[model samples]
Target: MDEVARAFLLPSALIWCLAGWFAASRRGLSSSPVFAGCWLLALAGNLSLILAAELLVFYFGFALMTFAAYGLVVHQGSPQALNAGRWYLFMMFLGELCLFTAVALLAVAAGAATALGLASYHGLTLGLFAVGFAIKLGLVGVHTWLPRAHPVAPVPASAVLSGVMIKTGILGWWRVSEPHGPLLSDWGPWLMFLGIVTVFYGIASGLNSREPKTVLAWSSVSQMGLAALLAGLALTSPGAGHLAWLGIAWLVLHHGLAKAALFLGAGLFQDSQGKARGWIGLLLCLPALALAGAPFTSGWFAKAALDAAVIEAGQGAWLPWLLTAGAVGTTLLMARFLHSLWVTPEADGLPTRGPWLPWGFSIVCVLALPWTAWVPEHVRDMANGPLALLSALWPVVLGLALYMALFTRPATAIRWPWRPRAFGPRAAIPALLPGLVHVERRMHRWSVVGTLFMFVIALLLAALSLRISGPVA
Candidate 1:
């Protein structure tokens, strides 16, 4: 866990500084007082995490980062930016409340001991912790904020938010649900279910998206799902859970760098031209492939560790296949993102200037990490094996085939069945704004949201009681 904190803090510091530089230059916030304030608050937030040794300290760090990010999101001050920031804050507060309540209950349950004590409260605390972090992770049902906030925020802020901040939520879950002395076996399956749902939902949403950043946002949603799956697997199998932590940590590190690179690269690609654009496109594939868990990359290595943990735990055979399918979906989404970058026309008269050094550094990190000691022993051993290689290869192959079939060809246009209009392949996916925005609007209502939070707490308590008691018979 200390290693996880260190891993995150290093990147948080790097990206936070870079993001501030980029936001000032890219978003024209150089003269704005708000930018300075957000920068300070965000720095304090990261410091809190680094200095934290206990629950309250961690919560304070989490809260500072959460609210500070709102300023980053709304820096543009446009209606869309404001709306996205509003939703971001709404979910942020809700998640904080859930985490605070759970931590408070946990401290009380420990009696004289602090929140770090290896004691388990019934399912209530575990459930609250899971849901709270899931909100931050942007897991399927609660993920409305992520896609909105990511696209609306300036490039660097989106990079850091996707890269570093979200991982804090995963860290919280690890501390709360995983450990030696206490077991929360019943909570495991529920988390696994959420992971599965989030994986597919993110892919589907990414496929449906038109904006490059929004597509990347949905990719984070999917990748975080993979993280949740591993965490849940660990919860069910405590012995292997410790080993699984290696996989989780690897995922966070590799994904954070690669995803950050891709987001930053997306910003660069927008205004690039001719030879420069071609070069950027080629560079883009490195992070995209890394993200897809291609063989020999950090993603594949981390995924191998996760797979080994799941197999060691004797989880059902279905999981390995599902994980592979999730990989295929991820590949498809990355393919779409790359395609969008390739085809979309540059903005009218937008300056060609971009932060090339940061993007390049990110690319370097993505390539360098996997080949080093970061690749877990289990992955290192099997990475070259024929079956293991094939398992990784097949998904990318299928994604490429599907991409060629659906997107590259001109004659393969399909009819739109759901909408009143008959549309071509280009128009296959309808705008997601209407339905998703409508749902977010209702969720933003203070009274209704407050009621929902209380209901979630009560429901978790009732379920915890039921689990604690024996069967009625």
Candidate 2:
């Protein structure tokens, strides 16, 4: 495998292993074979796709990973979990259809071995890929399922779902788009615009939520937005391509490791008592700070690289400022997460074997990232300068101040899209975007609508095939 595949594959495996251990510790290994089997199968799909040398192998792996994860999402077997599963399944089906159509068109064009011919169908293929990747990345309109799924799943399952699985969307984009240079020129700006919307939408959505996992899920959406932004930069300029992918890689690692830790730590807080809760909060802060881009942390390292990419791409007039603004939103999102954890009612104090060792290992891995040889020397140095440190620190300070002002006021002062219910099976406040959720529900009213959507796609595919095969009658 090449360096990029190797880079993504290793961390994905590491996080899955750690997360599985935590799941077992929390859920008990012997209790259910279903979770274990689905988990391992998903791992295989995630890793194999990364290692796949060909496009079709990658597509099969993506399908495997997507369907297998439904088991994880609905493991709790609650009504809520079942509901979330429906949303997840519906979205995946649509995403897969989009991808299949795109890949098929790509293959037909590539078989001709002519860039000029490939360019002819570039717009259609690019649009299909965008919709497909957007569903997986959980961009704003497609994002309702994420908060729904996260709160209902077991903590470890949630970790891999949020941390590892969403990233496959980014990986899929990289694998599909990297080969065909034809679409990038026209398509790049739109991707960046989608990224910006996702960034702010995620922050706004998460900020309003009171559930810890829901808040973190929103944070994942926002981070994915940043990934999209970096992706846009790469697509915008050939010169910035290498560094932009590098920045995306850094983001994948930083966010995956930190967010997983946050999820695991959230689990630990549930069973924790007074003293243990205090300690758990202490450990959770490391990842929390990283997500907020605290200096010298992996988040800072990744963000700095992105900044360099913006400058390198000569989009310095606006993109960097938007990113800096994103940093402030991220800081507040992190603060909300921590606040949710603190406010969660304590669980049964009867403690069994906890997930301390694995969770601690994850934390160590997170903190150690900046010093790792994998990081560039200059990116590492970005954490050290006096001005650089302030640039990182100020957003965090401002976010905290805003959090105190907004949330600390009287409870009745605010009306969020959803409010926190008591922590339990029904704890998650359902549906962040009620309007979109309504649309999603109406679409699901009958299976025929889904089939009709498929039929439409099938017609599109046939048209593309004919376009490639011959002139229309």
TM-score of each: 0.87, 0.87
Global lDDT of each candidate: 0.76, 0.79
Residue-by-residue lDDT tens digits, candidate 2, 1-473: 88779779878988999998887777454378998899988999998888877666777888899999999989888998999898888788888888777667766756733221123345556567677777888886666668789999889999999889989888878876665543466567877898999898788777767799999998998999988887887888868888888889888998999998999989888878879889999889899999999887898888888877887889867777788889998988898888878988887657655779889999999999888898977577656689888988888888888777556644335554364533321222133334433344454444644664666487567546555532111
- Superposed on all Cα atoms, model 1 deviates from the true structure by an RMSD in Å of 4.3
Candidate 1 matches the true fold with a TM-score of 0.87
Q: Cα RMSDs of all predictions?
A: 4.3, 5.0
**lDDT tens string, model 1, 276-301?**
77899899999899889888887778
lDDT of 2: 0.79
**Model 2 clashing-pair count:** 0
User: In candidate 2, which residue pairs clash?
Assistant: none
Error of 1 at 211 (Å): 0.7
